[model samples]
Target: MPEKVNGIVADAIRRVRTSSGVPLAFAGVVTGPTTLRLQHFVGQHVGALSGLSVDVGHGLGGKVVALNRLLAVDDYLRTPQITHRYNTLIEREGLRAVMAAPVIVDRSPVAVIYGAMHTPTPIGGRMLDALASEARAVEQEIVAARARMEHAAEGENEMRDRMTAAFARLRDLAGTVDDARIAEELEAITRVLIAGEEPAEEPTVELTGREQDVLSLAALGYPNARIAETLGITVHTVKGYMKDAMRKLGASSRLEAVVTARRSGLLP
Candidate 1:
Protein backbone atom coordinates (compact mmCIF):
# COMPACT_ATOMS: atom_id res chain seq x y z
CA MET A 1 0.00 0.00 0.00
CA PRO A 2 2.81 2.44 0.79
CA GLU A 3 4.47 1.70 -2.52
CA LYS A 4 1.22 2.14 -4.40
CA VAL A 5 0.63 5.47 -2.69
CA ASN A 6 4.16 6.57 -3.51
CA GLY A 7 3.54 5.73 -7.15
CA ILE A 8 0.33 7.73 -7.21
CA VAL A 9 1.96 10.73 -5.58
CA ALA A 10 4.91 10.55 -7.97
CA ASP A 11 2.59 10.47 -10.96
CA ALA A 12 0.52 13.36 -9.65
CA ILE A 13 3.46 15.70 -9.03
CA ARG A 14 4.93 14.74 -12.37
CA ARG A 15 1.69 15.73 -14.05
CA VAL A 16 1.61 18.96 -12.02
CA ARG A 17 5.08 19.87 -13.15
CA THR A 18 4.38 19.03 -16.77
CA SER A 19 1.05 20.81 -17.02
CA SER A 20 1.86 23.88 -14.92
CA GLY A 21 5.55 24.17 -15.72
CA VAL A 22 6.46 24.31 -12.07
CA PRO A 23 10.23 24.34 -11.68
CA LEU A 24 10.01 21.97 -8.74
CA ALA A 25 7.33 19.45 -7.88
CA PHE A 26 7.32 17.17 -4.90
CA ALA A 27 4.98 15.34 -2.57
CA GLY A 28 4.70 13.65 0.81
CA VAL A 29 2.22 11.09 2.06
CA VAL A 30 0.74 10.67 5.50
CA THR A 31 2.81 7.99 7.17
CA GLY A 32 1.14 8.19 10.53
CA PRO A 33 -1.56 10.11 12.39
CA THR A 34 0.79 13.10 12.76
CA THR A 35 3.57 12.42 10.25
CA LEU A 36 3.95 13.33 6.58
CA ARG A 37 7.16 12.30 4.89
CA LEU A 38 8.45 13.79 1.66
CA GLN A 39 8.98 10.71 -0.45
CA HIS A 40 8.56 11.73 -4.11
CA PHE A 41 10.33 14.51 -5.95
CA VAL A 42 10.63 15.90 -9.50
CA GLY A 43 12.71 18.73 -10.96
CA GLN A 44 14.60 19.01 -7.69
CA HIS A 45 18.20 20.12 -7.77
CA VAL A 46 19.25 19.21 -4.25
CA GLY A 47 18.61 16.50 -1.67
CA ALA A 48 17.86 18.85 1.23
CA LEU A 49 14.12 18.23 0.98
CA SER A 50 14.34 14.49 0.49
CA GLY A 51 12.71 12.34 3.17
CA LEU A 52 11.98 15.38 5.29
CA SER A 53 9.26 14.81 7.83
CA VAL A 54 6.53 17.39 8.26
CA ASP A 55 4.24 17.09 11.19
CA VAL A 56 0.75 18.51 11.32
CA GLY A 57 0.77 22.32 11.81
CA HIS A 58 4.56 22.54 11.60
CA GLY A 59 5.62 23.63 8.09
CA LEU A 60 4.11 24.58 4.75
CA GLY A 61 3.14 21.03 3.91
CA GLY A 62 2.09 20.49 7.46
CA LYS A 63 -0.15 23.54 7.43
CA VAL A 64 -1.72 22.31 4.22
CA VAL A 65 -2.47 18.97 5.80
CA ALA A 66 -3.69 20.60 8.97
CA LEU A 67 -6.01 22.90 7.06
CA ASN A 68 -7.04 20.37 4.44
CA ARG A 69 -7.02 23.15 1.82
CA LEU A 70 -4.84 24.65 -0.91
CA LEU A 71 -2.17 27.15 0.06
CA ALA A 72 0.16 29.32 -1.98
CA VAL A 73 2.95 31.69 -1.08
CA ASP A 74 5.00 33.87 -3.40
CA ASP A 75 7.96 33.60 -1.04
CA TYR A 76 7.92 30.53 1.14
CA LEU A 77 10.68 31.81 3.43
CA ARG A 78 8.65 34.88 4.36
CA THR A 79 5.22 33.31 4.49
CA PRO A 80 3.49 34.36 7.71
CA GLN A 81 0.84 31.67 7.40
CA ILE A 82 3.30 28.81 7.88
CA THR A 83 6.10 28.35 10.37
CA HIS A 84 9.64 28.68 9.02
CA ARG A 85 10.98 25.48 10.49
CA TYR A 86 12.23 24.25 7.11
CA ASN A 87 13.88 27.51 6.09
CA THR A 88 17.35 25.97 5.75
CA LEU A 89 15.96 23.11 3.69
CA ILE A 90 13.86 25.43 1.53
CA GLU A 91 16.83 27.74 1.10
CA ARG A 92 19.02 24.88 -0.08
CA GLU A 93 16.37 23.90 -2.59
CA GLY A 94 16.09 27.55 -3.80
CA LEU A 95 12.31 27.44 -3.71
CA ARG A 96 10.32 30.68 -3.63
CA ALA A 97 6.86 30.49 -5.01
CA VAL A 98 5.32 27.43 -3.39
CA MET A 99 1.87 25.96 -3.41
CA ALA A 100 0.45 22.84 -1.86
CA ALA A 101 -2.83 20.94 -1.98
CA PRO A 102 -4.06 18.26 0.34
CA VAL A 103 -4.85 14.89 -1.16
CA ILE A 104 -7.98 14.36 0.89
CA VAL A 105 -9.90 11.11 1.06
CA ASP A 106 -13.16 10.63 2.93
CA ARG A 107 -12.77 14.10 4.42
CA SER A 108 -9.34 13.33 5.87
CA PRO A 109 -6.07 14.49 4.43
CA VAL A 110 -4.02 11.55 3.22
CA ALA A 111 -1.14 13.36 1.53
CA VAL A 112 0.23 16.68 0.33
CA ILE A 113 1.47 17.63 -3.17
CA TYR A 114 3.51 20.75 -3.83
CA GLY A 115 4.65 22.90 -6.74
CA ALA A 116 7.32 25.53 -6.45
CA MET A 117 9.39 27.93 -8.53
CA HIS A 118 12.93 29.19 -8.19
CA THR A 119 11.91 32.83 -8.51
CA PRO A 120 9.39 34.56 -6.29
CA THR A 121 6.77 34.71 -8.97
CA PRO A 122 3.30 34.64 -7.51
CA ILE A 123 1.64 31.31 -8.28
CA GLY A 124 -1.30 31.84 -10.60
CA GLY A 125 -4.88 30.72 -10.08
CA ARG A 126 -4.66 28.37 -13.04
CA MET A 127 -1.71 26.58 -11.50
CA LEU A 128 -3.53 26.30 -8.20
CA ASP A 129 -6.54 24.88 -10.00
CA ALA A 130 -4.38 22.33 -11.76
CA LEU A 131 -2.82 21.29 -8.48
CA ALA A 132 -6.21 20.94 -6.86
CA SER A 133 -7.51 18.77 -9.71
CA GLU A 134 -4.55 16.44 -9.50
CA ALA A 135 -4.99 16.20 -5.73
CA ARG A 136 -8.59 15.15 -6.26
CA ALA A 137 -7.50 12.47 -8.67
CA VAL A 138 -5.06 11.20 -6.09
CA GLU A 139 -7.81 11.07 -3.54
CA GLN A 140 -9.97 9.04 -5.89
CA GLU A 141 -7.19 6.61 -6.66
CA ILE A 142 -6.45 6.01 -2.98
CA VAL A 143 -10.11 5.38 -2.29
CA ALA A 144 -10.25 2.92 -5.16
CA ALA A 145 -7.13 1.11 -4.02
CA ARG A 146 -8.56 0.70 -0.52
CA ALA A 147 -11.82 -0.62 -1.96
CA ARG A 148 -9.96 -3.20 -4.05
CA MET A 149 -8.05 -4.38 -1.01
CA GLU A 150 -11.26 -4.78 0.96
CA HIS A 151 -12.94 -6.72 -1.84
CA ALA A 152 -9.95 -8.99 -2.12
CA ALA A 153 -10.20 -9.78 1.59
CA GLU A 154 -13.89 -10.56 1.17
CA GLY A 155 -13.16 -12.84 -1.78
CA GLU A 156 -10.75 -14.82 0.40
CA ASN A 157 -13.43 -15.41 3.01
CA GLU A 158 -15.92 -16.42 0.33
CA MET A 159 -13.44 -18.87 -1.16
CA ARG A 160 -12.88 -20.45 2.25
CA ASP A 161 -16.60 -20.92 2.75
CA ARG A 162 -17.05 -22.48 -0.65
CA MET A 163 -14.13 -24.83 -0.03
CA THR A 164 -15.59 -25.91 3.28
CA ALA A 165 -18.97 -26.64 1.71
CA ALA A 166 -17.39 -28.59 -1.14
CA PHE A 167 -15.38 -30.68 1.31
CA ALA A 168 -18.50 -31.53 3.24
CA ARG A 169 -20.39 -32.48 0.11
CA LEU A 170 -17.53 -34.69 -1.04
CA ARG A 171 -17.45 -36.50 2.29
CA ASP A 172 -21.21 -37.12 2.16
CA LEU A 173 -20.98 -38.48 -1.38
CA ALA A 174 -18.06 -40.73 -0.41
CA GLY A 175 -20.18 -42.37 2.28
CA THR A 176 -22.77 -43.44 -0.38
CA VAL A 177 -20.20 -44.76 -2.91
CA ASP A 178 -20.78 -48.52 -3.52
CA ASP A 179 -17.35 -49.27 -5.00
CA ALA A 180 -14.44 -49.35 -2.56
CA ARG A 181 -12.09 -47.92 -5.18
CA ILE A 182 -14.50 -45.06 -5.92
CA ALA A 183 -14.84 -44.33 -2.22
CA GLU A 184 -11.08 -44.24 -1.82
CA GLU A 185 -10.76 -41.84 -4.79
CA LEU A 186 -13.42 -39.58 -3.33
CA GLU A 187 -11.63 -39.52 0.02
CA ALA A 188 -8.36 -38.65 -1.73
CA ILE A 189 -10.09 -35.82 -3.60
CA THR A 190 -11.51 -34.50 -0.35
CA ARG A 191 -8.06 -34.56 1.23
CA VAL A 192 -6.61 -32.63 -1.66
CA LEU A 193 -9.44 -30.08 -1.46
CA ILE A 194 -8.82 -29.50 2.26
CA ALA A 195 -5.02 -29.67 2.01
CA GLY A 196 -4.73 -26.04 0.93
CA GLU A 197 -3.43 -26.51 -2.59
CA GLU A 198 -3.09 -23.30 -4.55
CA PRO A 199 -6.23 -22.52 -6.45
CA ALA A 200 -6.12 -21.68 -10.15
CA GLU A 201 -5.36 -18.04 -10.80
CA GLU A 202 -8.11 -15.88 -12.17
CA PRO A 203 -7.71 -13.06 -14.63
CA THR A 204 -7.05 -9.72 -12.99
CA VAL A 205 -9.08 -6.64 -13.74
CA GLU A 206 -8.36 -3.39 -11.96
CA LEU A 207 -11.06 -0.90 -11.07
CA THR A 208 -10.78 2.42 -9.29
CA GLY A 209 -12.83 2.95 -6.14
CA ARG A 210 -15.03 5.53 -7.79
CA GLU A 211 -15.43 3.33 -10.84
CA GLN A 212 -16.50 0.42 -8.65
CA ASP A 213 -18.78 2.69 -6.66
CA VAL A 214 -20.45 3.95 -9.82
CA LEU A 215 -20.82 0.47 -11.27
CA SER A 216 -22.12 -1.00 -8.03
CA LEU A 217 -24.81 1.66 -7.79
CA ALA A 218 -25.64 1.25 -11.45
CA ALA A 219 -26.09 -2.44 -10.80
CA LEU A 220 -28.86 -1.55 -8.36
CA GLY A 221 -30.79 -0.05 -11.31
CA TYR A 222 -29.96 3.55 -10.48
CA PRO A 223 -29.72 6.17 -13.17
CA ASN A 224 -26.64 8.32 -13.60
CA ALA A 225 -28.30 11.32 -12.02
CA ARG A 226 -29.41 9.35 -8.99
CA ILE A 227 -26.00 7.83 -8.62
CA ALA A 228 -24.45 11.27 -8.77
CA GLU A 229 -26.86 12.52 -6.15
CA THR A 230 -26.23 9.57 -3.91
CA LEU A 231 -22.49 9.76 -4.26
CA GLY A 232 -22.34 13.59 -4.19
CA ILE A 233 -20.73 13.81 -7.61
CA THR A 234 -21.90 15.42 -10.82
CA VAL A 235 -23.73 13.33 -13.33
CA HIS A 236 -21.01 13.97 -15.88
CA THR A 237 -18.29 12.74 -13.51
CA VAL A 238 -20.33 9.63 -12.78
CA LYS A 239 -20.64 8.92 -16.49
CA GLY A 240 -16.92 9.40 -16.95
CA TYR A 241 -16.10 6.95 -14.17
CA MET A 242 -18.61 4.48 -15.58
CA LYS A 243 -17.08 4.81 -19.03
CA ASP A 244 -13.59 4.23 -17.71
CA ALA A 245 -14.79 1.20 -15.73
CA MET A 246 -16.53 -0.21 -18.81
CA ARG A 247 -13.37 0.18 -20.84
CA LYS A 248 -11.32 -1.59 -18.18
CA LEU A 249 -13.91 -4.37 -17.95
CA GLY A 250 -14.17 -4.62 -21.77
CA ALA A 251 -17.89 -4.08 -21.55
CA SER A 252 -19.98 -2.03 -23.93
CA SER A 253 -22.76 -1.23 -21.50
CA ARG A 254 -23.27 -0.52 -17.82
CA LEU A 255 -24.93 -3.87 -17.19
CA GLU A 256 -22.00 -5.69 -18.74
CA ALA A 257 -19.58 -3.65 -16.67
CA VAL A 258 -21.48 -4.48 -13.50
CA VAL A 259 -21.54 -8.16 -14.35
CA THR A 260 -17.87 -8.23 -15.20
CA ALA A 261 -17.01 -6.35 -12.03
CA ARG A 262 -18.86 -8.86 -9.88
CA ARG A 263 -17.21 -11.78 -11.66
CA SER A 264 -13.85 -10.10 -11.19
CA GLY A 265 -14.60 -9.54 -7.51
CA LEU A 266 -14.63 -5.79 -7.95
CA LEU A 267 -18.23 -5.61 -6.93
CA PRO A 268 -20.11 -7.45 -4.16
Candidate 2:
Protein backbone atom coordinates (compact mmCIF):
# COMPACT_ATOMS: atom_id res chain seq x y z
CA MET A 1 0.00 0.00 0.00
CA PRO A 2 1.14 3.54 -0.67
CA GLU A 3 2.23 5.33 2.50
CA LYS A 4 -0.42 8.02 2.17
CA VAL A 5 -3.22 5.56 1.43
CA ASN A 6 -2.28 3.24 4.30
CA GLY A 7 -2.53 6.18 6.64
CA ILE A 8 -6.01 6.96 5.37
CA VAL A 9 -7.21 3.35 5.52
CA ALA A 10 -5.86 2.81 9.00
CA ASP A 11 -7.42 6.03 10.21
CA ALA A 12 -10.73 5.21 8.58
CA ILE A 13 -10.98 1.67 9.93
CA ARG A 14 -10.27 2.85 13.47
CA ARG A 15 -12.83 5.64 13.23
CA VAL A 16 -15.57 3.47 11.77
CA ARG A 17 -15.31 0.70 14.32
CA THR A 18 -15.09 3.06 17.29
CA SER A 19 -17.98 5.24 16.14
CA SER A 20 -20.37 2.63 14.74
CA GLY A 21 -22.16 -0.27 16.40
CA VAL A 22 -21.06 -2.70 13.71
CA PRO A 23 -18.81 -5.62 14.61
CA LEU A 24 -16.91 -5.66 11.36
CA ALA A 25 -13.20 -6.18 12.01
CA PHE A 26 -10.86 -6.83 9.09
CA ALA A 27 -10.12 -6.30 5.40
CA GLY A 28 -7.82 -7.93 2.79
CA VAL A 29 -6.66 -6.33 -0.40
CA VAL A 30 -6.38 -7.94 -3.86
CA THR A 31 -4.37 -5.67 -6.09
CA GLY A 32 -4.24 -5.30 -9.90
CA PRO A 33 -6.48 -4.20 -12.77
CA THR A 34 -7.04 -7.63 -14.30
CA THR A 35 -5.14 -10.43 -12.54
CA LEU A 36 -5.97 -9.96 -8.84
CA ARG A 37 -2.71 -10.47 -6.95
CA LEU A 38 -3.45 -11.08 -3.31
CA GLN A 39 -1.94 -8.52 -0.98
CA HIS A 40 -2.77 -9.41 2.61
CA PHE A 41 -5.42 -9.26 5.27
CA VAL A 42 -6.18 -5.90 6.86
CA GLY A 43 -8.23 -6.24 10.01
CA GLN A 44 -8.89 -4.72 13.41
CA HIS A 45 -6.83 -7.48 15.03
CA VAL A 46 -4.91 -8.75 12.01
CA GLY A 47 -1.57 -9.71 13.50
CA ALA A 48 -2.74 -13.33 13.49
CA LEU A 49 -4.08 -13.75 9.93
CA SER A 50 -1.18 -13.07 7.59
CA GLY A 51 -0.25 -16.55 6.42
CA LEU A 52 -2.82 -16.70 3.63
CA SER A 53 -2.30 -15.76 0.03
CA VAL A 54 -4.62 -14.54 -2.75
CA ASP A 55 -4.41 -18.10 -4.04
CA VAL A 56 -7.14 -18.74 -6.60
CA GLY A 57 -9.42 -21.77 -6.02
CA HIS A 58 -7.93 -22.36 -2.62
CA GLY A 59 -9.14 -21.28 0.82
CA LEU A 60 -12.15 -19.15 1.70
CA GLY A 61 -10.43 -15.96 0.73
CA GLY A 62 -8.95 -17.82 -2.19
CA LYS A 63 -12.49 -18.72 -3.29
CA VAL A 64 -13.64 -15.13 -2.94
CA VAL A 65 -10.42 -14.32 -4.69
CA ALA A 66 -11.33 -16.55 -7.60
CA LEU A 67 -15.11 -15.97 -7.81
CA ASN A 68 -15.27 -12.30 -6.90
CA ARG A 69 -18.17 -12.88 -4.52
CA LEU A 70 -19.05 -12.71 -0.82
CA LEU A 71 -18.41 -15.78 1.37
CA ALA A 72 -19.35 -16.86 4.86
CA VAL A 73 -18.28 -19.72 7.07
CA ASP A 74 -20.03 -20.57 10.34
CA ASP A 75 -17.38 -23.01 11.46
CA TYR A 76 -14.00 -22.44 9.91
CA LEU A 77 -12.78 -26.04 10.04
CA ARG A 78 -16.02 -27.80 9.06
CA THR A 79 -17.24 -25.34 6.45
CA PRO A 80 -17.63 -26.62 2.91
CA GLN A 81 -15.15 -24.24 1.31
CA ILE A 82 -12.98 -27.20 2.39
CA THR A 83 -9.73 -25.39 3.02
CA HIS A 84 -8.31 -23.14 5.68
CA ARG A 85 -5.34 -20.82 5.29
CA TYR A 86 -4.88 -19.70 8.86
CA ASN A 87 -6.38 -22.40 11.00
CA THR A 88 -4.09 -21.68 13.90
CA LEU A 89 -5.11 -18.05 13.89
CA ILE A 90 -8.78 -18.97 13.83
CA GLU A 91 -8.35 -21.32 16.73
CA ARG A 92 -6.33 -18.79 18.63
CA GLU A 93 -8.94 -16.12 18.08
CA GLY A 94 -11.65 -18.61 19.03
CA LEU A 95 -14.00 -17.16 16.41
CA ARG A 96 -17.11 -19.05 15.34
CA ALA A 97 -18.83 -16.84 12.78
CA VAL A 98 -16.96 -15.29 9.89
CA MET A 99 -17.98 -13.43 6.75
CA ALA A 100 -16.06 -12.03 3.83
CA ALA A 101 -17.43 -9.55 1.32
CA PRO A 102 -15.81 -8.76 -2.01
CA VAL A 103 -15.14 -5.10 -2.61
CA ILE A 104 -15.60 -4.71 -6.35
CA VAL A 105 -14.74 -1.98 -8.80
CA ASP A 106 -15.26 -2.39 -12.54
CA ARG A 107 -16.92 -5.75 -11.86
CA SER A 108 -13.73 -7.09 -10.29
CA PRO A 109 -12.71 -7.94 -6.75
CA VAL A 110 -10.20 -5.36 -5.64
CA ALA A 111 -10.35 -6.31 -1.97
CA VAL A 112 -12.21 -8.25 0.70
CA ILE A 113 -13.18 -7.23 4.21
CA TYR A 114 -13.87 -9.88 6.82
CA GLY A 115 -15.74 -9.77 10.14
CA ALA A 116 -15.66 -12.30 12.91
CA MET A 117 -17.14 -12.76 16.37
CA HIS A 118 -16.03 -15.23 19.07
CA THR A 119 -19.41 -16.92 19.15
CA PRO A 120 -21.45 -19.20 16.88
CA THR A 121 -24.16 -16.60 16.32
CA PRO A 122 -25.15 -15.80 12.76
CA ILE A 123 -23.70 -12.65 11.23
CA GLY A 124 -26.55 -10.58 9.85
CA GLY A 125 -26.50 -9.69 6.18
CA ARG A 126 -26.69 -6.01 7.14
CA MET A 127 -23.63 -6.36 9.36
CA LEU A 128 -21.61 -7.97 6.60
CA ASP A 129 -22.06 -4.61 4.87
CA ALA A 130 -20.69 -2.49 7.72
CA LEU A 131 -17.28 -4.10 7.23
CA ALA A 132 -17.01 -3.28 3.54
CA SER A 133 -18.63 0.11 4.05
CA GLU A 134 -15.73 1.45 6.10
CA ALA A 135 -13.37 0.37 3.34
CA ARG A 136 -15.01 2.99 1.11
CA ALA A 137 -13.41 5.67 3.22
CA VAL A 138 -10.14 4.63 1.65
CA GLU A 139 -11.63 3.75 -1.75
CA GLN A 140 -15.04 4.83 -3.10
CA GLU A 141 -15.19 1.67 -5.19
CA ILE A 142 -16.21 -0.26 -2.09
CA VAL A 143 -19.47 1.63 -1.57
CA ALA A 144 -19.92 2.15 -5.28
CA ALA A 145 -19.98 -1.60 -5.87
CA ARG A 146 -23.10 -1.98 -3.70
CA ALA A 147 -24.87 0.13 -6.31
CA ARG A 148 -23.58 -2.39 -8.91
CA MET A 149 -22.37 0.19 -11.39
CA GLU A 150 -18.86 -0.58 -12.60
CA HIS A 151 -16.51 2.22 -11.57
CA ALA A 152 -13.24 2.71 -13.43
CA ALA A 153 -11.44 3.48 -10.18
CA GLU A 154 -12.23 -0.06 -9.07
CA GLY A 155 -8.97 -1.63 -10.17
CA GLU A 156 -6.05 -2.78 -7.96
CA ASN A 157 -6.90 -2.21 -4.31
CA GLU A 158 -3.49 -0.69 -3.60
CA MET A 159 -3.57 1.65 -6.58
CA ARG A 160 -7.13 2.60 -5.70
CA ASP A 161 -5.90 3.28 -2.20
CA ARG A 162 -3.13 5.52 -3.48
CA MET A 163 -5.34 7.21 -6.03
CA THR A 164 -8.18 7.83 -3.56
CA ALA A 165 -5.98 9.13 -0.75
CA ALA A 166 -4.09 11.31 -3.20
CA PHE A 167 -7.35 12.73 -4.51
CA ALA A 168 -9.56 12.81 -1.39
CA ARG A 169 -7.70 15.75 0.09
CA LEU A 170 -7.84 17.48 -3.28
CA ARG A 171 -11.57 16.80 -3.57
CA ASP A 172 -12.19 18.41 -0.20
CA LEU A 173 -10.10 21.33 -1.36
CA ALA A 174 -12.26 21.44 -4.46
CA GLY A 175 -15.49 21.36 -2.46
CA THR A 176 -18.54 22.96 -4.12
CA VAL A 177 -16.52 23.27 -7.33
CA ASP A 178 -18.20 22.33 -10.59
CA ASP A 179 -18.19 18.61 -11.52
CA ALA A 180 -17.12 19.31 -15.08
CA ARG A 181 -14.03 21.04 -13.78
CA ILE A 182 -13.18 18.21 -11.43
CA ALA A 183 -13.68 15.66 -14.17
CA GLU A 184 -11.31 17.59 -16.41
CA GLU A 185 -8.56 17.62 -13.81
CA LEU A 186 -8.95 13.89 -13.07
CA GLU A 187 -8.89 13.10 -16.76
CA ALA A 188 -5.67 15.03 -17.24
CA ILE A 189 -3.75 13.80 -14.16
CA THR A 190 -4.62 10.17 -14.82
CA ARG A 191 -3.06 10.28 -18.25
CA VAL A 192 0.40 11.42 -17.17
CA LEU A 193 0.72 9.52 -13.88
CA ILE A 194 -0.18 6.19 -15.49
CA ALA A 195 1.99 6.85 -18.52
CA GLY A 196 5.07 5.29 -16.86
CA GLU A 197 6.87 8.61 -16.76
CA GLU A 198 8.19 10.75 -13.96
CA PRO A 199 7.28 14.42 -13.77
CA ALA A 200 9.95 16.87 -12.55
CA GLU A 201 10.06 18.77 -9.28
CA GLU A 202 9.13 22.21 -10.56
CA PRO A 203 7.99 25.19 -8.53
CA THR A 204 4.27 25.77 -8.17
CA VAL A 205 2.52 28.30 -10.35
CA GLU A 206 -1.10 29.21 -11.10
CA LEU A 207 -2.08 27.74 -14.47
CA THR A 208 -4.31 29.62 -16.88
CA GLY A 209 -7.78 28.15 -17.53
CA ARG A 210 -6.65 27.12 -20.99
CA GLU A 211 -3.57 25.51 -19.53
CA GLN A 212 -5.66 23.61 -17.02
CA ASP A 213 -7.98 22.43 -19.77
CA VAL A 214 -5.18 21.16 -21.93
CA LEU A 215 -3.31 19.45 -19.09
CA SER A 216 -6.49 17.70 -17.97
CA LEU A 217 -7.03 16.29 -21.43
CA ALA A 218 -3.39 15.34 -21.74
CA ALA A 219 -3.48 13.57 -18.39
CA LEU A 220 -6.36 11.53 -19.67
CA GLY A 221 -4.20 10.38 -22.60
CA TYR A 222 -5.98 12.51 -25.17
CA PRO A 223 -3.97 13.44 -28.23
CA ASN A 224 -3.58 17.12 -29.12
CA ALA A 225 -6.01 16.93 -32.02
CA ARG A 226 -8.62 15.01 -30.02
CA ILE A 227 -8.32 17.45 -27.14
CA ALA A 228 -8.69 20.31 -29.59
CA GLU A 229 -11.91 18.83 -30.93
CA THR A 230 -13.32 18.14 -27.46
CA LEU A 231 -12.56 21.58 -26.05
CA GLY A 232 -13.38 23.38 -29.29
CA ILE A 233 -9.85 24.76 -29.34
CA THR A 234 -7.20 24.55 -32.05
CA VAL A 235 -4.50 21.90 -31.92
CA HIS A 236 -1.97 24.73 -31.99
CA THR A 237 -3.51 26.23 -28.85
CA VAL A 238 -3.27 22.82 -27.16
CA LYS A 239 0.41 22.61 -28.02
CA GLY A 240 0.97 26.07 -26.61
CA TYR A 241 -0.64 25.12 -23.29
CA MET A 242 1.48 22.01 -23.11
CA LYS A 243 4.53 24.21 -23.51
CA ASP A 244 3.35 26.46 -20.69
CA ALA A 245 2.79 23.49 -18.41
CA MET A 246 6.22 22.10 -19.22
CA ARG A 247 7.86 25.38 -18.33
CA LYS A 248 5.82 25.81 -15.14
CA LEU A 249 6.69 22.31 -13.93
CA GLY A 250 10.27 22.57 -15.19
CA ALA A 251 9.46 19.31 -16.90
CA SER A 252 11.33 18.21 -20.02
CA SER A 253 8.51 15.80 -20.90
CA ARG A 254 4.75 15.42 -20.44
CA LEU A 255 5.22 12.55 -17.95
CA GLU A 256 7.32 14.70 -15.66
CA ALA A 257 4.66 17.36 -15.41
CA VAL A 258 2.12 14.71 -14.51
CA VAL A 259 4.33 13.06 -11.88
CA THR A 260 5.00 16.40 -10.25
CA ALA A 261 1.31 17.25 -10.21
CA ARG A 262 0.34 13.88 -8.71
CA ARG A 263 3.14 13.91 -6.11
CA SER A 264 1.95 17.40 -5.17
CA GLY A 265 -1.54 15.91 -4.69
CA LEU A 266 -3.08 18.41 -7.09
CA LEU A 267 -4.46 15.84 -9.53
CA PRO A 268 -5.91 12.32 -9.35
Question: Which pairs clash in the backbone of model 1?
Answer: 144-209
Query: Which residue runs of candidate 2 sit more than 4 Å off their true CA positions?
Result: 1-12, 15-24, 32-46, 50-52, 132-268
Model 2 lDDT tens row, 26-98: 5556644333333333344445555444565565666776777777777776677647765776777566677
Tell me the spans in candidate 1 whose CA falls farther than 4 Å from its real position.
175-178, 195-268
For this target, which candidate reaches the highest lDDT against the unseen true structure?
A: 1
Instruction: Give lDDT tens digits, candidate 1, residues 99-201.
Output: 9999988788888999999988888989999999999999899889989989999998677546545554565567677999999998787657534543232
How well does each candidate superpose onto the true structure, as a TM-score? Answer: 0.70, 0.44
Highest TM-score model number: 1
Superposition error at 217 for model 2 (Å): 19
